[model samples]
Target chain A: MRSWLRSEDSWAVLTGLLVLLLGLLSLAGVNALGWVPKANEWTTPLKAVSPASKAFALPGGVSVLLLYTSLLGFLCLGAWRMGHSVKRFAVGFTVLFAVGYGCWVLGHYAHLATTPNKMAEKGITWGLGLTSESGYLLALTAGLLVGNFFPKAGEWLRESARTEWYIKTAIVIIGGVYGFKAAEDVKLTQTVLVRGLAAIIEAYLIYWAVVYFLARKVFGFSREWAVPLASGISICGVSAAITTGAAVRARPVVPVMVSSLVVLFSVVELILLPFAAKLFLTDEPMVAAAWMGLAVKTDGAAFSSGAITAGLLTDDPAQQQAMGLTTSTVKVFIDLFIGVWAVVLAVVWAYGVDRKPGQGVPLKDIWGRFPKFVFGYVLAFAGLLALGLWLTDPVAKKAVKEGMEQADQLRRVFFVLTFFAIGMGANLRRLWAEGLGKLALVYAISLFGFVIWFGLLVSWLFFHGVKPPTVGGN
Target chain B: MPDDKRTAEELAKQQAEPLLPAEKWLIFGSISLGLALLGVLLWLTGAM
Candidate 1:
């Protein structure tokens, strides 16, 4: 039994199982506590406005569950023989965790009562409303930091077979949440067409043309590291950078630098963009939302910016909804393109880096490097949309809706977990080694470019006589 | 032992030189120009 368990394949299976189990148990615990209540009085009215009212419940449980498991996994990995430092882990986890908790606290208490029928019109509230999943996940991340510092307690929990089992279960269950079909259900119109096209173009140009030059030319980054660092800053932020780094076999330090810069810049954007909107474009909520959505690198920062913009424009419901929908939709559209962009970069890197007399990329290199799970994600979204369309029966539709909703909830949880893992993996020392000057330059250039492109698109689309309806007035 | 040595050699061989001093200034200039063009275009279009 000992020999069998000690085998490499056996260890892999064991670890996988541990991840899944932990995810499930944490999910169950979060749900049981009603820590994040499914039905809130505040969001009910907003639910009524939405075509899918039943799918209004916040997926906080999934978020918390993912957070806890991911943190646990990171701690476990850190505790292993790997050269993971406690101080580095603690620092990264603490900042991310605090941000998460702040979100949760804001969700639970902040009220959006300025508008009449405050419950139905799901405007941005300070404490908690529908999309507080991000907050709960953040809190879980904080808990991980606390747990990590207490090594004796962490060790006690780590020794247990049950704990291991739980973590593995959570990872597997997390996979079920990435429903491909839901992606198709997201309606695309003229607004989406323009935004989607802009996002894709901006992601590449900012990464290559702007951020790349800054990283290499200004900051004095080597080509090896500059590519991934710029890609991360310009594309979808940390995750995109990390994914691209892994695919291109970039130096570990590259991802660390990217993650640090991303986290720092994201926080800055969150604070600055809302103020910029209020000060500069107070009368133009749609333009403000569009600018925030396009300029901000991360979804969380964009959402935060949108929420602040909504708060500023509380007197106008139509404007508030438009702002909220536009920011969320644009961010989601950007998220959807992460896989495609990664693939394109992977192909580029193969030819550019791996093909020469001394270095030759394999034929199967791109396929091997590509993130296959994204295919599963796209497939699940497409499959569900097909089901939703083909099955005309109300009962069938209801079931599909429920399934998709659950999947979305699960997806949120996985994202939280992934972020937690990312935080765990992150270390400032690694980032310092990569140098800061280049990263700073890249981020500045990218932001500048994004602002201009996004602003142009908004002006072209809505500048002329497009009197967007004022809140509650139209 | 030979394989490990060969791998190390290959890794060392793959390392590219960091950006040159002139190259740095050129990149900086290009990025600045791009950003300026974008900003001007947006301003002209009444986006600001």
Candidate 2:
């Protein structure tokens, strides 16, 4: 119980809600989050940074400093409680934030990130047009260089490089954004949420069955190996693999091996799938969003893929936000099922597959396996949603949006950190040296030959013909 | 039937034993099917 209380998951929820609470102070007419830094597209360095809100008219560098200090303090508090070396973490996080945010500012250069619509005014004939979120890709690439080439730096930074916690915090902040959008158009937002739930359920059942069969019959893996592999590849990646591993009483090595592969492949999917979705599914934006949630494995990679795909597929900020919300909604629904599915697997393995005398299903493991950070996500979302619905005054509604805007900017900062952390944690040489030939082959075949296409089909079935509400239109 | 076919059938059934208790499969299948139906209904109503 003590260990669970101090776990990274619990800290992530607490940290995330603390940020949201500060932002929520806008309801009382104090924009506590307004000083958060935002990077804007610019031809020159001087024009690139600003306070997230016009109300806090601090100089750009000051805004960045405020952001850094607050994040360092908030994260260090968690590190201290979680039994990490707070001094080392603070130092490592400082360097990481500097380098990561530097790449983010570079990605905001006019020639690299300016969209087509703004190209004319910027006097550039063409730009990469990846949108401001290009910072995520830039941060990822820069971190990969540090990880693969600068082994000493990677080791030094390892104590603070927490990809999952960063992404979960970002997710909770995004839930607030979703709630604000919901207030704007309840019917549309609810539809996206409902479709996302249905799509994940339909896709998961088929995905698990097919992958399990393929691993068992085609790859000729044993049940112990196949069950966790299927769940890892078919469900929410590392968490699902670990939970299913415990459920089936597999050796720890089984889930650990599956987890490394999931991370590597999730990064690969993050890099590749967004472009493919943009190319093939651009017209059906919601389908593309759902596809990203289902096809990408890890939460960080999945949410990042959604943002990149949304950036590529549209110029409208409203549409891009909607795409991201749809993706998160689907992924969260999938996350909700990990505990339930763990129980199902436990029951089956205990009674049917490898039952031994005195071996009972570990039903209590379900609660242990539940993703704790999801509570923060749901709370932020529901709180903002209830406030949106209850507030009748237009003035109050505008303040709510203003507050959420600050939270959204902070979410982007966490996302950039997540991208860099994910890249740094991916050790290509280690994955290669581990003799993962059969398992890699199975993942390749199952993912490319079956899972991706099946996910696209399921997404299309549920989300076809649905479009997000255009700006100012419901 | 050929001897090989008979052997394969026996092997298949033996391998399938763990997945028995067809009731479990039935319940999961019904849930999935119901969700699919709900999706279609929602789509038809433009509520999903």
Candidate 3:
């Protein structure tokens, strides 16, 4: 027991668990007390006001600003500790935060409300209510930023036994929201199945082929760096890359570059995709949702895009929900492939670099290296789905649903905090010393390849003669 | 002899000299400028 506690990995895990708990607690407290800002309140800063009026607003405004202040404090601390490398991390974090914040703001402006009350009333939830969902997101962002500043503090926040329980519980709750029952409702045609599989395969192939060639020939990046970058960009973005990098024992700079590129491109895609869908697509929510899911690398980006598109294209509440669910479900499916892709990349790297038959790492070792928490995530999701389906009673379903929603919200909050912590740990000097030329080339190749494959396969399978499943419609 | 040669290689690798501070700054500045330009372009195109 003492030995287990002494392990560095164990400590990190413990820290993560605690942080997850804090996030959950904060989420529950914020939700219950209504600490989140309403849509209208978000716009308050932009409103014309006299000096006298502004004075009264200042107090409330200052509270709102606390979140940003905490984030800045965390950044400063991380910079101080991490030294020269801190700059790169700061840049990456800033890009990610800016994009995420922009999306939240845009989503609010678009009036994309998922709650039943707003849906039924067909009115926007307004004001700077501290209990609003957006407010919670803001708070989570702030918490993460603060966490990033002090690694020890961040670890402590994440590692408590309570946080571990909360994280697992949250994952279970999010499962219900994913609608596992709805999974069967959508008929899987040969076409749909083929398209999905094809998209996955093509995405992988394009990523590897393009990134490999560019990294080796154009950028002169070591194969070690190229493999992880390609895996990350082509699969689930930063998370996938980080996991694979750890598994293969790639240099730290490789993962950093991959993460930075992922953040940059993710933001670009988030802003670009919605507008593109609006302009080009036929205003079919499912089609738009599918497009967003297939094109965007991350679930959050896909969901935000889907929500915005749904708001613009449809007035039907059911349709909006369906779109949101579809985008999320698709992205989660893509996320599941991260482990498989990472393992495969690990094998390739081992054999290619070491040039030994049976001398490469055993499959068991690779399996051990894989991130295990992801399974907990999957289990939680699956559990929710089963519970949602088996429990026929409306009251019970509602209760379960609410529980899941709270948990899902908590998980997202913790994830944001984790990202903030990562940003704080980043170092710019190390990145610069390594030379960005190679990294940039790898990123460009991977991104370009992914976009091409995603666009082509999605269009060919779903858009061109084939019809995909709808939520309620046959 | 092999050990000596390996040590020489290690020494050479270590002695491969890092970029000058001025050169490093120039590279960083160029990258920042490029990113800024890209951001501006994105904004102008209403992609932001």
Candidate 4:
């Protein structure tokens, strides 16, 4: 309904859909989104900015200006519709975009981001070899410094710091990225999709039950507290915890407490798991990739972990693509189906557990609880896939190359912004706050003691032998 | 009692209660689903 526009999830979907549609117009020889800016690895700052599409050449300054104006217009429209002050949002957003994208450009400095393979070409004997995704980490660090050290700036930027919205939008764009690849190699795509499906099902059914048992019996938490905590730790973190709280009709404070812990632990996972995967599971690239999706709780953290893992594990572009694709496939499937799991819990609690005389669990609740942005992700993926299969002309090829590539660049920009927003949202001081001690202890125990290792085992079961397609497959 | 203290007492008291029949069913159902899914995955991957 028209009222849905107020939801950030709907706005993310709409924004992503608009980008996809504009990109698709290139199949008709229209280059509407070609002006979007992309930063490249560079020794000098001036060389960093360029149009995303190789087909269109524009002045670097013009490219950045065009991207800035376009993003502000689109996002400001959403803010206005959502009953936010467009003026304040625009002011905050401009500062965020400038600083966040500056961090992005800084992260791409040749000395910092040039991979080992390209070290010689960049005339650098030594480089961090973190790949360009270091931008994400830099952006996060920059935002955290502001959030903790400069509280006023952080508060001012709060109006535009929509972490989940940015990440969900990026995920929709990534769906197109994979969908375009799927068009080229249907068999490999089929394999990862099926594998990802299995991984998420196993994740939900096994991980949730185990965590719930531990929280209730081992940690001595009440059913009210344990349910949301289980959902948060074993499933997709904040969204899962919030939905499960609603399903079980628990106090709102229960989910809020659980969600804060989920955020804290997810940040921990984001920092540690990628390096762990690189060290232990690099030989099994797909396993490492799927492990990130399965283990990391938040979408931003999960996807960012995947990107960082790809950078750490190998310098090969093909292997990196493979890893990113596998992680996104698994995480997206998990995000897509959490609503059904919530519905199941609702029925079980209402009908079988409490059995309150007047209370009824309606099927319509699933619709209300469903994440609408997933629809955008599915639409983008399926639409791109259908187009890829249906069109085979030179113009279509150009569209696939230039348009999709530009869309990928836009997706990366969103990802960097998401990292910054996530960091800005996380208040490190809150972890030490009173009344969170029990929740934090339960999380630390359940997550590290069992959940993470179990996730790795499940990921290996599903994705062990699978390999991403070679570079030319793209 | 303060809200936090009351809530904590309630949680602790509930924790000592025996597992409800419905909770048992939920656990059983989840494990069954997990096993079935694992079986299907093994078959699909030719690992069975």
Top-scoring candidate (DockQ)? 4
lDDT of 1 by residue, A190-253 (tens): 3433444444444554435566776555555666667667766666665567666765667666
Q: Say which candidate scores most in TM-score.
A: 4
The order of the candidates by lDDT, greatest first, is 4, 2, 1, 3
TM-score of chain B of each: 0.54, 0.49, 0.53, 0.56
TM-score of each: 0.53, 0.91, 0.56, 0.94
Off by over 4 Å in 4: A315-317, A362-366, B1-17
How far in Å is the alpha carbon of A151 misplaced in model 2?
2.7
**Candidates ranked, most accurate by DockQ first:** 4, 1, 2, 3
Q: How closely does chain A match the true chain A in each prediction, as TM-score?
A: 0.55, 0.97, 0.59, 0.96
lDDT of 4 by residue, A180-243 (tens): 7677777777777878887667668888998898887777787888889999998888888878
> Ten consecutive residues with minimal summed lDDT in candidate 3 chain A?
A47-56
**What is the per-residue lDDT of model 3 for residues A151-212, given as tens digits with 9 covering 90 to 100?**
45444433221222223233333344454334434343222333344345444544444545
Candidate 4: tens digits of C-alpha lDDT, residues B1-48: 124555445554663646788998888789898889788877877642
**Displacement of the residue A354 alpha carbon in candidate 4, Å:** 1.1
lDDT for model 4, please.
0.82
lDDT of 3: 0.46
Deviation from native of the Cα of residue A307 in model 4, angstroms: 2.0
Per-residue error for A2 in candidate 3, Å, reads 9.6
**Tens digit per residue, CA lDDT, model 2, B1-48:** 123333234323434323345324634574566466655755665642
